[model samples]
Target: MDHDLALIVGLVLIILSIPSIIAAFSDGHAPRVAAFTIIAGGALLVWAISSKPGGYTISDVPDTFVRVVARYLP
Candidate 1:
């Protein structure tokens, strides 16, 4: 449950950061902060998902976890 929540929140942050990053790029403001945020959030989400509880074993290479993580951002 905790892992799921962390993954969800981190992905949300990454998704939210994209528009701000694009806006910064178009407006000639350095997007360094937004880029950093995206990287950090992505890392956190990956870590959280990878650290899921011991009961379940992941069988599929591209499962719902990957879909949920990648869908909104890309």
Candidate 2:
């Protein structure tokens, strides 16, 4: 996938895992799925950043998310 798409997916996965992690903690269970999700998300983020020239910055994330969403949506 392109850098923008990868970035968005990685961020989304990480964001989504937060709730699962919280729920697991509240239930006193292991956050195995959440941990895996975080790992996958981190891997995607690393790949996207390393593959892209000049890399990305905090200021660029909003634009990247908008660009990826617009490209996929009708």
Candidate 3:
């Protein structure tokens, strides 16, 4: 997968898992799925960072997302 795509998916997965994790904890249940999602997201993030010549910075993230979205959608 493209590094940009990996980055986006990883971020989305991690973000989406937050509510699941919170709900699981509130219910006194193990956050098994959310934990897995986080792990997968982390792995993808690592891969994207390592594969890219220069790793992403906080400021570059929004631009990267916009570029990727524009590329894929248009």
lDDT of 2 by residue, 12-32 (tens): 999999999999999999999
Give the higher-TM-score candidate: 2 or 3: 2
Measured against the true structure, the TM-scores of the candidates, in listed sequence, are 0.63, 0.98, 0.95
* Candidate 1 whole-model C-alpha lDDT, 0 to 1: 0.72
Q: Scored by Cα lDDT, where does model 2 land?
A: 0.97
Better of 2 and 3 by lDDT: 2
Once model 3 is optimally superposed onto the true structure by TM-score, how far is the C-alpha of residue 59 displaced, in angstroms? 0.8
Model 1: CA > 4 A from native: 53-74
The reply for model 2, stretches above 4 Å from the true place, is none
Ranking by lDDT: 2, 3, 1
Q: For model 1, how does the per-residue alpha-carbon lDDT over 1-74 read when each residue is reduced to its tens digit?
A: 45655666676789899999999989999999898889888887777767876523346323646765676566
Q: How well does candidate 3 score on lDDT at residue 28?
A: 100
What does candidate 3 score on TM?
Answer: 0.95
lDDT (Cα atoms) of all candidates against the true structure? 0.72, 0.97, 0.95
Q: List model 3 lDDT by residue over 1-74, tens digit each.
A: 99988999999999999999999999999999999999999999999999999998989899989988998895
How many backbone overlaps does candidate 1 show? 0
